[model samples]
Target: MSGDRGAVELEGVTKRFGSMVAVDSVNLSVKPGEFLSLLGPSGCGKTTTLRMLAGFEQPDSGFIRISGEYVQGVPPYKRDVNTVFQHYALFPHMTVAENVAYGLRQKGVPKSEIAAKVAEALDMVQMSKLAERKPRQMSGGQQQRVAVARALVNRPSVLLLDEPLGALDRKLREEMQIELKLLQSRLGITFIFVTHDQEEAMSMSDRIAIMLDGHIEQLGEPETVYEHPSSAFVAGFIGRNNFWQGVATEHGIRADDGTEFVASRPEEDVPNGQPALAAVRPECINLSAERPADSNNVTAGVVAGVSHFGDVLQYVVSVKDRDLLVLTPRAHAARFQQDDNVFCHWSADDVYLFSARQADIVMTDGDEEIHDN
Candidate 1:
């Protein structure tokens, strides 16, 4: 809208639907030209928040600013933002070029100018060669490219992407992730991506706002949030970890089996005597025939399960009180078989501690959380 910082801000943003509060009072800020993601499970208000930004929905109480200008009442058509939806909602009767030019035509741009801009937008998405093709004639990926070109053709300062790659196959989704990021960078536009997919958000966003229950649970750069989760929800949501139910002590945390896990961090800062959760990723666990010398957290466990993931081998090991996960590099020459007795050792630095704030998660049956780390 104005200048390049592509700044987007939300202060005390609250949205309500009848008796239900879809988005609680939330605060967020995005730097100009930054790729930020609203990441969480369904019903977490990510889509609602995005719709608010695009002016399709209004917040009950909040201020939204784009490019440093307040846009509380500005409608979608007047706002300098373009949306690329999950479905490639293209016009069936129009070719890619015509679809892209539709917006400019509605604005009544000169015929010559519209043609030039349409060609440029298609070229920007590497879809110029297919400009004459209709949406039904193209693959999912190609159709989505046309959608992207249509959104970009408007030259909006901010791009709002609502799961733009959700319809593609796995490999194609991954490829589009990289490609879309490159396009965002090359165009230097501010992008706000919404998704329930953790990996997609992690791969593309400069910063991720992890949301839950109508609030943002954590917001940070991908690596920072992954390595230093601020809450139990984050530690369990971000990455695969072996979780242990425990009680907090001043020195460390005591697992249910009475095994004390001393992390590089302390449990004293956590409420003493409260239920706690300790987690460590599979790759952080060390596997050996015997306990590693000078290891702080080591356990004897049986290989409960093992699976090959190309470059890495993932193992689920059952210790006396806790089930630990161990990830071994495929390059490692040593191998273990299922049911083999082994010692799993991990450094304190690899451990994360959290309060048992989500007892409900233990009762849930399905794995709906993204676990972005």
Candidate 2:
């Protein structure tokens, strides 16, 4: 823990249980002071990846390195890493400072040094005020902060968290996200966070690695991964998406609902007459009160539902027999009711083009058949 407390590399790591593969061959590198999240649905191998990093499970193949040193035979206690789980796992009878000092005590550190380090760690998480309080005396958020302090106190090279805030209420959970992010920056330590909450990963991560069926689907900055998803699975999993099945053509694509729209995708990838998938984010779609001037990627629809969020409005419009989600800003939210005819328009760039995978089942309204214009 006294050396450079960052830099991790995973080379073609794979883990299997019995005949089932829990983790496929995976490669990743985390830089110092970076906040990286392993995001996916449950049983997608994200938690397994975290366990491998923490030395809880040995990889069936490949190698792992920490701070430029190979740790193939290293154990959890020997490695400069610590984990904070969703359950705080605090000692119910121990005071905050005592709980934080337990790790040091087990290491047989001197009494004077343990007291000094414990005080310093509690201060870092802004919890020094409640150092003497028991776990039952503090709120959930505060207790979680103490857990964080315990992990940071060790000053590990890498900190691993597995859904650390899953138990908190909505408002408190959001507040903790901000606090944890700020703490990571202030300490400048690498944080490897694992979570299934898409919004949590999007808001807190510097880079997100999306996993599906034990494979890494996409890895990039949050905006890059969100705005330009590489595959249909990643697009549908990372955020809310509306999809339509179509056939690729040189001009564009012809949806099964008879809506012809222009799209930008590689020729080699989108072979002519091959099946394709079209995806657009809710925020990228625009809702207009009247008919739009142009015809490129523009169509008419009726507002099927309107949901009022605090600062934004979510509109579901039925276009070409498909329910499309659109986001309207609060300031521009006009009185629009269900069944009102409206225009849905978007730029060609906003539309994501991906090859139609096996899970290309489209939810439609049974309005019209696809047409190629």
Candidate 3:
């Protein structure tokens, strides 16, 4: 792939399947050599957008350009990009080396040079020792590495991955995440990764484009999105949060449970007395056995549940018939038992206030556990 590549541009991109619009009028610009992730829940059009970029699907009413060249009607084989899907898709009969060399052979590359390129690609993914193994003989992670090698073997300027780590176990997935990130940095190639996994997107991407209902919801660095979410959906989707439904008050918001909150840095402006939703991250909340003094953000609750997650402790505090989740470091964990009285307090700076206009899109605790699909 050429190192001197230009930006990838999508202008008014839209795609539809029957009555449903898979992708809306979306516009995006990806910097050269940038790692950008398309993140959202299932049916949010993340995969469709990536397919459009890979030349597997065409936009109904938009234009796409790769490396400064318009690629209308271009076939996947001809596009200057490669796609790696969740499934390995490798031929069961073919060895890893043969699978990695398939594209070169199909394109009629000189046999003299094919082996060298295959070796280079396999080495890039650290799969040289398994080059002779078939897909069925290797673990999911190994097969995934070979699949990635096959894509990289083509030397495309851009790589599009659709939840490439979704098939692995937690530990293996995390290991591959680190490996893929390091590989991308070494190559400096443009990577447009599509995943529903928030942690995956946050850890591997330079910037994340959170999509919702076929449209781009928010685009920014992971920290920016997590600290200052643009909408209730963005705040709820990017990380764990406790939400309160209420009406906007003069200073903050009045919850349906009769608790009021003040957000020192509200991302959006809402008229006074209007309905709104407030969110705060679990780690931002401080839990204690004693009531906090002189704080409007403090609420009385009882410990409903406790979960230990290695280095962190998660608490479910029941306040006013609502179960609010709170996270604390294991070292700083408060010894509160189920049914024990507790106090939850947070600073105004840690609160996120959003207009109730997005309540329908924002997820709640009752919603299915949000994961990258």
lDDT of 2 at 11: 94
TM values, all candidates:
0.94, 0.92, 0.96
lDDT of 3 by residue, 1-373 (tens): 2443736899999999998999999999999989999999899999999999998899999999998888899888998899999997999999999999999999999999999999999999999999999999999999999999999998888999999999999999999999999999899889999998888999999999999999999999999998889998889888888888889887788988888898877778978888888888999999998888957799999899999999998899998867889999999946777889999999998888888887766763324442211
Model 1 error, position 260 (Å): 1.4
lDDT at residue 45 of model 3 (Cα atoms): 100
Pairwise TM-score winner, candidates 2 and 3: 3
Better of 2 and 3 by lDDT: 3
Model 2 agreement with the true structure over 241-325: per-residue lDDT tens digits: 7777788767667888888777764322677788887777788888888777877888899999999999889998998766888
Among all windows of 10 consecutive residues in model 1, the one with the lowest summed lDDT is 363-372
Candidate 1 ranges beyond 4 A from true positions: 1-5, 266-268, 362-373
Report the CA-based lDDT of candidate 1 relative to the real structure: 0.84
Please give, for residues 52-167, the per-residue lDDT of candidate 1 as tens digits. 98999999998999888889899998887999999988999999999999999998889989999999999999999998898999999999999999999989989999989989
Clash totals in order: 5, 4, 2
Best by lDDT: 3
The Cα error of candidate 3 at residue 168, in Å, is: 1.2
Q: CA RMSD for every model?
A: 2.8, 4.2, 2.6
In model 3, the runs with Cα more than 4 Å from the true position are 1-6, 364-373
